[model samples]
Target chain A: MDEGSAALVAAGLGKRYRRGWALRGCAVAVPRGRIAALVGPNGAGKSTLMALATGLLRPTEGTVAVRGKPGFLAQGKPLYQGFTVEEVLHAGRALNPDWDDAYARRLVAEAEVPLGARIRTLSGGQRTRVALAVALGRRPEVLLLDEPLADLDPLARQEVMGALLAEVAEQGTTVLLSSHVIADLDGICDHLLLLSGGRVQLAGDVEELLAEHRLLIGPRELDVPAAAVVERRETGRQSTVLVRGLEPPDDAQAHEPTLEELALGYLRAGRTSGREVAA
Target chain B: MTWVAWRQQRLLTLVSLALVALVGAGMAALWADLSSVLPADPAVLDERYGDLLGYVPFVMLAMPVLLGMFAGAPVFAREFEQGTHVFGLTQSIGRTRWWATKLLVAGLPVTVAMALLGLLNAKALGPLSSILTSRLQTPMFESQGYVLGAYTAVAFALGATAGLVVRSTLGAMAITLAGYVGVLAAVANLGRPHYAGTEYSASGAVEPGAWRVEIGYLDAQGATTTFAGQKCGETPIAQCLLDQGVAGRFARYHPVSQFWEFQGAESGIVVLVVGVLVAVSAWAVRRVH
Candidate 1:
């Protein structure tokens, strides 16, 4: 377990529920000081995989390792109901040998978490903030957060995201946060693990995903390269095509797509044709 | 970190202390009224004081059950119910450490409450032993049954285990109460030798008929009344005695009384039994996805 090289590593992770596999044979490698965003639709196992990686739930099969104590923020900000805000922070200090009490207090004070107030008395956003403070106080080498900004209001979302971004910048902690809120991940994450139907539909550096997968829009009458086209949506006069591999035929007069478009294309390709990422 | 755990459980500590206060106040008033109202003839007061002392133990039996339900049941149950355990399990502590800390933190206030009450009772009733020679002539200020101290620890541990298993505050509560009642009832009436199996006789054969414990109750008139029942409704061997005929009135004469009852072998067994349950509970919680 080299401190710099292996922030977190998962080999062939899987989780099976009574209904079916929530996550099936998943593998991921997170490097130190990098931010990875696990993006998937409602039931794509983003949270499940994060939980397994953090050791909150034992994998049905596979191995996961963290170089040091991993800080984990679950899918929802779960907290003791009757404890005062200060008391909740104390729990973090008591449990984590590497706790930074000053840092925890700073975050709480900045977030305006009333130290005397009970957790049950705090608003939902306030509770989430306190939870974030607790997680950050650990000064962990690896941080795993599931849906960190799922329920936050737009204003609070930015504030929370900014706080996280600041911590990552200062401490260089490897962070893996999952979100259906794609925009939240756009600027913060360097890596992406896009999943669907219990498998990784596409996963790699965000730059690689944008570079390799091209979304094309052109005339329906024009010749579309069969191999380049992975999925397409046609609407009478114009057509939108999602292409994988080399540049969308230089010969075809089509406009390149945005990251959102490429993501949608990857998902649409998986839905229509059973195309799955090799990794 | 230990401080944090103690702080988290401060409310329970306060509640336990409040209970001690109430018991203290109530005992003080009862003693003053008893000594002042009874005839100056020490003999007359002696004749009635023992039964009044009996109430102390009788009422105190419910303390363990109460503490077990309120404090122990919520130790882990509320965490699961609120999903807070996810934070606890993922933190730096091992599952064992987490539970051990909770038991320690939660046990403090209960011990303090019991100890303080014990001291007060001793101060108030120790002097009466010489004058109240009749077993039934103890003072109204007598200490409650010592078994309550052991029972409270056991019940609290058992309730915490139930809390971990049930994962819901209300559900844990219901299960804990039912378990306490069931175990106590089984111990009192069933006459079985063990929790899970029948005890074998020296003959190496299963015993024949169900064993019964007959309890004789002496009413205010001083006549004895008896009731008979199977020890545990199990195979024939007599089980642990839960309570005697007059709601444990004979505890003063019971062998456990000669020594400090709370420090007896039964106490050790209670602690061990609940401890095993708590360990199993931690393992079970780990398996919960």
Candidate 2:
């Protein structure tokens, strides 16, 4: 495997269904060993891209390349309902030729999931842990996790992310996980890809992306360059505009936008564009 | 991949085989006890076995559909319903290997068991040939030979294909049952008779176990008699036949001795259907979301 190569690269990726395209012209690359977040609203092609990258679904018009074998924790963390946790791990071992049994066992042990318990018997948190263990068992160079924290409570979500981060840190594996909520991933993900309307709306180093955008507070009737504003909101007293890669105008007070504000701005921008296309 | 697929279907496959084994045990006992009542004619058969004659073949006929619905319908359908196919297909294995291994692992045991079961049923019912009508005939033919196994394979394939297409276990099972019955009806009525050339007999003494395809009188000129001519519906039909100058009753039939030939032919047709189903399923698996 090429250690310096991007963990995953998609070029002009497009996926079509019976009625319409789910994803189109998608292109992004996450550098090796980065914790990348795929942020989007529901039905923004986040899951579609994840599915394509993991090879579960093929692209209708492009290609996805993974530097090495990828391990996927699919949406809902689907373990065979009838299988015990041990059997699920056994299935992981059987399916993956390069399975790391020790790592798989340690993950389950650390999470306190009982080996003999059926998958359906486990609660949401426990099931997520077991599913993650199965994916990690393959010792893949890149791990694609789709909605790993969707069903967990806030505390459980923190714990699951903590566990996931701890493992990825130790192994130095690249990971790309998808989520609709920005607050959950605001701190953990250093690389970000925001998707909407089957395209990449924003993608880059999270810190860099944040630093490039500023929230400008100006008068409600203030005039500004349309090209400079990523998104805007107006009130009777004031207008708040998200400006990208620019200084505030002469009369406005500029403030650094929080990661959530930045992400929300981009997500809304993408959705508006998507609706325009649909209309 | 094979192990994973086998594990998924293990319990159902074993249970289905156990059901076949149970049937085999009873049939074996029947075969063992069959010699005591042999060499008798049909008149004494009713006094001997009575309604038991009807019960055995009915069970035999139902086995393939039962096994097909139980074993085949849920293979892919349940995976999709539970969302486990996402896990299965995303593994390092190619979709084709996953689909093919599943088909083979899930299908092999029941097919071999049904074939063996059919052999047992045939052997068990052989001595009662006078009472069984003919192994080469309808309903009886389906129960007694290798075609039974082939029917099972076709039914199983139908079920498995339906699962992939419908993506629902209950839907697949319903399709399997309906498709199995439909295929059997179509083959018995339309496909079986064309397997080989039928033998023509000059007398009404067509051999027992031979399937009677058609029968008509042949006149002195050796032309087949038509219904529009001198009616045989008259009283004293023997005298009426003489008055009409009918020389013989010509019969077209599949002989009892052609049992293996018919088995090979019918089984081949159904197995071809099985092949098509498998190929379609293999293609459909890749297309599933």
lDDT string for model 2 (B1-289, tens) is 8878888999999999999999899888877776666667766865676576787877877899998899999889989999999999888777888888889999989999999888888887755655656766667788877788998899889888999999999999999999998988899889888888999888866876677889898888889875335465655777777777777788898877777888899999899989889888978987876
Interface RMSD of structure candidate 2 (Å): 1.1
| TM-score, chain A, candidate 2 | 0.95
Give the DockQ (2 decimals) of all models.
Answer: 0.63, 0.74
lDDT, candidate 1, A1-279, per-residue tens: 233485777778888777767877777777778898888778787877887787777877877777766888897888887788887877888888888999989988988888999998987678888988899898877888899788889888888888888987899898888888777778678888777767777777787767777666677765666877768788998777777774655545554555566566776677533323222
Instruction: Predict model 1's lDDT versus the native.
Output: 0.68
The digit string of per-residue lDDT tens for model 1 on B178-220 reads 8776655544334212222223232222211222122234433
Off by over 4 Å in 1: A1-6, A81-85, A109-126, A219-227, A250-253, A271-279, B28-58, B115-143, B190-265
Q: How close is candidate 1 to the true structure, as a TM-score?
A: 0.77
Best by DockQ: 2
lDDT of each: 0.68, 0.86
How far off is residue A97 in model 2, in Å?
A: 1.0
CAPRI tier for the interface of model 1: medium
Name model 2 segments beyond 4 Å from true. A1-4, B228-236, B242-247
In candidate 2, the second chain superimposes onto the true chain B with a TM-score of 0.91
